[model samples]
Target: MKINKFLLGAFALSVGFASCSNEEPIKGDNGGATDGEKYVTVRINSVGDIGSRAATDNDDFEGPAEGSSEGNVTKENIRFYFFTADGMPFVMSQTGVNGTVNTNMVKPDALNVSNTNGDEKTSLEAVLVLGAPEKYVGNRPAIMFCVANATDEAAFEQFAKKRLDAIPDIEVNTPGEWSKFRMTSSTYKEGEGEGAKVIYYTDISDNVKDTKDAAMANPANIYLERLAAKMRVKGLGEYTVMEKNEDGTLATAQYKIRDENGTTITALKVNLLGWEPYMTANSCYAVKNIDKTWTNTSLFNGWNNADLHRCYWALAPGIVSPNNNTIPLYDNNKFKYGNYDGNKPTENIVYTYENTSYQPASVTDRSTKATAILVKAVVKLEGSDEGIDMVEWGSDYFTLEYFKAIVVEAYNADKDVTNQATAKDVVLKKNTGADARSNTWYATVKGDDFKRFSNISWWQNGITSYFVNVEHLGSKYGVVRNHIYDYTFNNVVGLGVPGDDPVNPQDPKPSYLAARVHVLNWHVVSNSTILQ
Candidate 1:
């Protein structure tokens, strides 16, 4: 039994390629090519054309090595799907050992190929022996789709089992069915615990040739893409950090915003809690698809270079709200806290399916809202103790105790000598007929009816949040697969949304957070927003 060997190279860069350990012999009665069969060599490329976009502030996380059996781009198994020249599905006859071979796939022998030119490295290859009926020899398969790490028919919506003994067929020409095929966890059976697998697939319709000799000489190239995007939060430089002591031990953490000269703001402080993905999509198509009417196409200036398999925008499931709204305290899967070290980026990163909003007219529009990072933090005023919680009213911020004193003074000014009130007499105004949720602080004197007066209780617990919408290359706002979003907070000025609500969080009124976002190759994209 002889195994044909070839080479599969990494993407445009010298990384993210998968290699097989040993060649599995092609098992069949006919050891080699039969009368109607041909040999087609394919060089699968792992993630191609991640652009040369530079990071403005922080570096991206390192991708996994090709030889390693882990990471996002690793290919444990690969399968091929064929379509005739006329767009008809081509089903291969089950050859090899009956129970061992799937008609749609062939396990290739792994051979590492090193490029002498140093343009690329750690290549993988697979040689396929394609058999066809003698009658259809001249008009064999013309289009090929390569998929990696999708072995289980029970796992993917694209490979959902319709009957036993064989995988169901797909309508190659049916755009609706093809676009609906996804690699996601939403299709798993109840309690299957079979989380969504990181699957990669590519279309090589343009690479196929008419004859076997032509294909052998010019092996078809496939650039596999994972149907998800990655994001990381990093902080650049150091800050004037202030530690709050409780019982003579440091209990709370805070940082003072400084000017360009490193002069600290002594009156105000901020305590960064963590960040979570807002409006993140749970699923993406196995093969990315784009809308023909995507007018923001101009924004993809250096994007969608097929030669390098790099794309900037993709159509993803639209999400109006966050899947989870629980305010995370410590570190968890959904939320990650930044432990600043004044040297490197904090270990705050996440992976999510592409989430896009088509040419959103305004950021506040819920129907076309883009995916964002919800950064949670506590804004406080420097005090004798740890810090003092503040409340927002009208146009200014007042400490909780100070705001209470103003409310008590207002009540006394509105009353006679016998009707004067104190701090304990003030309470939140109650909602009544036709009135919305009372956003006012009310005065309830000894026997006087409660009177609604001023704004208060907006900043509950002194916690605030800011939403930083992820952006693509050009004019649009979105997250695309195989790209990295690195966001670093340079400085947080003023106060953000009072009482940060994970869902429906409002933009900061007077203050804002200055942050820089870099998306890497994972084509890296850089976005800088200065909040005032």
Candidate 2:
């Protein structure tokens, strides 16, 4: 980001001044003086682009090999929404020579925003220059920034400038509302994810008092949380990651998954996954393993963002603990919920890219907790029949690929044991839909609908990958039970009966896809019986 010494000097002179000599300046400010001497030179240190995070979507806490997107963020159409700490939107009143605004807004020099720097080592760019906000003039001030990618930059820009209230309702293609104007909190708790130490506004400005430090404790650092969960391909054999201190800790497995067509799938894109707006204060936060991870993160005392998350991620929705689905106010070791082993939750719960942060969006009741990732698939495997070739769930097939989702991680969290069910060439029957005491998509086959068997949840708590040979999955497994659930919505079943205009969330009756997979007989099932 080229900072024109000339422009910076002129900008500093014009803002807050009653008059200016900006006869040749970009803005109307020819040149002027200001009353207050507070100006924040915010550099865009975008944390967590897809490439940097791809490697860490694993058992390892620090991100992947420094430059693998793992297919998270995109290299093109990068955008960052700049705003006040209080959520007030800011427009681009100025852009230097290299600055240009697509439908989406851009900072003068965005480091990793577009991956222009070539790798995770972000370029020396991406910043927002601001006049001292009047609200925080006397009080300590801070800024908020969010990163997102959009196909249509103009559409994103129009959306980004609106008040948070109106942002969700507007419909724009490519960048869905959830992925679009739906702004996520960039203010991550320190030490949970990877990034530089956040800079306080006081530290950047002329303020001598560290009022913000006293009020918020941690400095204001903005991290772009990964919106998409990662799904990597691997064989049936479990590949455990040893501690770095342990011999061969650096060793890791490389998983490659292919579609029915045999095309190598480097990474799979995900959508319609569960996302809840910032949990309202005092709402319940249960079993988001990161919370448990936090005890060790900050020693269970304060918010430590980077240290808390094993893999900085968006929480996948579902109840993994089969024993208890109840969400508590919080779990800081007291009144804390335990895992299936009846042992209290701990930070060392073993990390996986697929998270178990199933905090209820509205802890008030069951009616409003409907945010889920919808999924439906149709594919013809090498020699599989029609039943095995196509699989469809959710309200409609007409929904775009953006809505089709995959369940990455689902486990029985309540107890140490999971249900053991077997599918004999299962083309699982869609037993019922939307209405029933329990709508189970039973893996029972009537005709040739069944193909080879596969488990929904991998034993190692990662994504379920394909293996051409059942022998590859192993020889000591039994039933692979894929737990299918149905929903009861507000007078609508299956995503609002198809024709609803702008068929999206925020509709009168929305549908969600939050799943939990419980497998039985890990200690008993033979690989021959399980894979066959």
Candidate 3:
């Protein structure tokens, strides 16, 4: 068996380029072409540590050689590699006209080249050119220089800038005396130039430490660090940074969104991906992870604005009437029956009805005639089939017959009952149609009936003409739910209780006696005169 030797130490410039003839080239079975391609070569001659004291001493610190220490003090050389829009690689080579090779040579196609100046060194220049001119166009190839030293870091940066500016079509814009330069090409727009962006790594003393701290402290810095860490882990070379900016506050930063591919996105529409409560009071809150590695099986789940609202609501205390004035008596146990006095009413009212078991014989007699008459008139105008039960008069339980009797009695009491009666005309027409439930009932009742209901002193005094008609069927029959009622008659004349429930059984044909209670005094009108 024969062994093939691999050429490992050959320099990129050593690749031999064979002269081409006008004859057809031969092709190999393994797809190797007989023709050869030419490539550009760049060279850099670094003068070695010019700004260091070691350069002045002839002592060889590392070796016994007479000039070893002097050589060690020479400037350091750097090279960069670039590819055309098409896939082609080139190495930059460095060559000095007056001195020996002290620094590392530049790569073949590197556009930006830099070297430090020694104390003894008066003038230093590097020669670089593309190896293959046929492969490129006008001003397609260029070079940049960055000079730096352990001391006076800004000097080398300035020198580099001056050198870069000397090159044709290269312009530097230093806006605020900032040490950075914005290099623009005369041939192209702001960011479209060949060497559009160039950064000088002048200070390396604490570069690593500073970058590490930034990565840990700043989100944007962390993002860069993560990218760098990924590059290292994946062994991916030639990674470039496009842009970075500070986040809203130093605490939390937002990066101009990116796509999966490592391309710098220029134009994008950023709609807040997560909930922002500070932006809107009604806004909900949510949690988001940056890694994007979360799966359905992960312990972390996505939340929305609704979830935030739930959290706030949970922490918030129950709505306590600002002054016991805004809340209805129905909610206040002390005022279980009805107490609008300033002093805190006694809790004794809470168990009064429970122990008595004695229901008010007539919810509305001559004594409470004004209140009863007003309620009946309102119910008639409301066209509420589920009549007011004893509950409306402050009873807890309802018998089917009793509920029906209350409705019959209220209907009979209406002296001027008319066939054209409808709650819409009487109650709803007067108020704004902003609330759906209220507007619906108002639109349904007759105008005449609404007027009559709105005119009754007691009903007008206690109940608002504008009331919402809610359906109480099934499980919802006995459950009191809130409704939006507006009163236009007087500022004080508002619906006492905003919640309502069906007095009769919703199903089973009323197997047991039931009564609908239109609980009164639940919500009071703000500016009503009668209630005040």
Candidate 4:
């Protein structure tokens, strides 16, 4: 895909050379030129298939019938040739069969042999101009003839006159007896695959006659006629490009089908080309329901369902991250508050115990849900970067904002508390708290309330340390240690009923819900005194 500058130049040069060589020869003015100096250019017109049928078992009658079975009909081998006014014999060139000949550098035996083979050889009429090296100017008429053996002479002559006669025309006895020929006119582009050959035939003209005898008398005319016949064959069988009557839409053309008589049957008003667009529109409508479902249900909720995830997983690999955290376990037996010695604790004492129990709350699923929503939003925004925005705010800033949003969402969802905040907030706090001691902090939440503070830096930082410790502690001890701190008496305290009763009894709420409950032990203690 990456083309070097030098190679590109070389390719361009090669293309130019090929283009120059492929250009069709233009006829020059030959006024008053001598017969020896005359020149002409001839080109191929068309090609087509010719064949005969043989009887086979498929056409046989089941019971004993009078007629024999007919075999499947197929086209025979195709032939191609060119038609031109130039008298020169057909010579295969790099571009195509050319008819122009160099009279000045004539070969020893030029035009010396007769074309009376009547089978293989053919000839054509060419303009004759007489001229010496410096005096060549005008052109004159020259007789056209072809050499073919006994078997092909008659057919070849007939073909030549039908094509080269002053008024080119043909006559058809029956519709099925139409003569076919190939027609090609367009110039080939450089580096393209081999040139295409078009086949067509002249429709019958009532006035034209089948002069087989006259064509045979003049053999050169036969060659010209055959060449013209080859050029007129239509290769793209029976095609039409129709325009819609109502709105100018392009309609498909009709195609030729075989009739019972084993002849090509041309159908009128057929619409073959329109089928593709019709099928495409139908398929879109068929899938309308699936698209509606995705639009109606929020994309975030749909993604969370395991089934939806599996579907997406099959469609696009590596979409879901591999490192999702497992759900935390909760303890049902642990007491929220410390046990008292009194047989019946006073109201104040009970209230105090209740308030203390609410110090720490358990983690909730809502936190995970919110984080999942944030991640989904980030991904969605990222996906829309390629779309056009109509708003005046301009697309560049929105593109930058999209990137910023991803980073912000990811940082906020981190278990570490320090990194949790909008970019603006992080910048302001960093500036204001420059003098304060800075250290890598960690956090662990005991109750469901962990969801609310999941975005905080302290928790995210703490999770990292906990993860590292668990890995170093190995499976046997890691699980036991996690059980103790992850679900203990202190951790489960604040997860119960509200301790404080609101003045409005209906709004019963916890008075002192504990934000977090975990040991804050750190291996690398910061030296705050040394910094001061």
| C-alpha root-mean-square deviation, candidate 2 | 20.3
- Index of the highest-lDDT prediction: 1
RMSD of 4: 37.8
Off by over 4 Å in 3: 1-205, 208-445, 449-532
Compared to the true structure, candidate 2 yields what TM-score? 0.32
Compose the digit string of candidate 4's lDDT tens values, residues 1-532. Answer: 1211111111000000001123543233332111222232211111011111121222211110112111100011112222233322222233211222232111111111223336433222122221221222212212222211111223223333223232123221111211221111111111212542111211111111123222233222110111110000001111122223346333432223222233232322211110000000000000001111331133322211111111110000111221122212121221122222123221111100000001111121111111110000000111132221111011111222232343356556764786465534321111113332221111122211222212111111001100011100111111100011111111111011111110111221111111111110000001100000
Model 3's lDDT to the true fold? 0.18
Q: Tell me the tens digit of each residue's lDDT in model 2 across 363-415.
A: 11132222221112111222332212122233222111111112111211211
- TM agreement with the true structure for every prediction: 0.66, 0.32, 0.15, 0.13
Q: Backbone collision count in every prediction?
A: 10, 48, 55, 74
Per-residue lDDT value at 371 in model 2: 21
State model 1's lDDT: 0.46
Ordering by lDDT: 1, 2, 3, 4
Instruction: Please write out the lDDT profile of model 1 over residues 1-532, one tens digit for every residue.
Output: 0111112234211111111112534443332222223444465554523234333544432343233222322233444555555445554444422122244333333333334336544445333344332333234555555555453443432542122112212311112211121221111111112441211233344444445455546555555555546677765322222333444322223334322244233555566567777666644555565433333244455444433544456655555454443434223353454533324322445666667745554332223446776676665555532434555555455555566667778778877898777777655543233443232343344545555444443444555555566766665688887677767776655455543223332333334446676676545665664322
Off by over 4 Å in 2: 1-22, 26-59, 62-76, 91-98, 101-105, 109-123, 126-141, 163-220, 233-532
Ranking by TM-score: 1, 2, 3, 4
TM-score-better candidate, 1 vs 4: 1
- The candidate, 1 or 2, that scores higher on lDDT is 1
lDDT of each: 0.46, 0.24, 0.18, 0.17
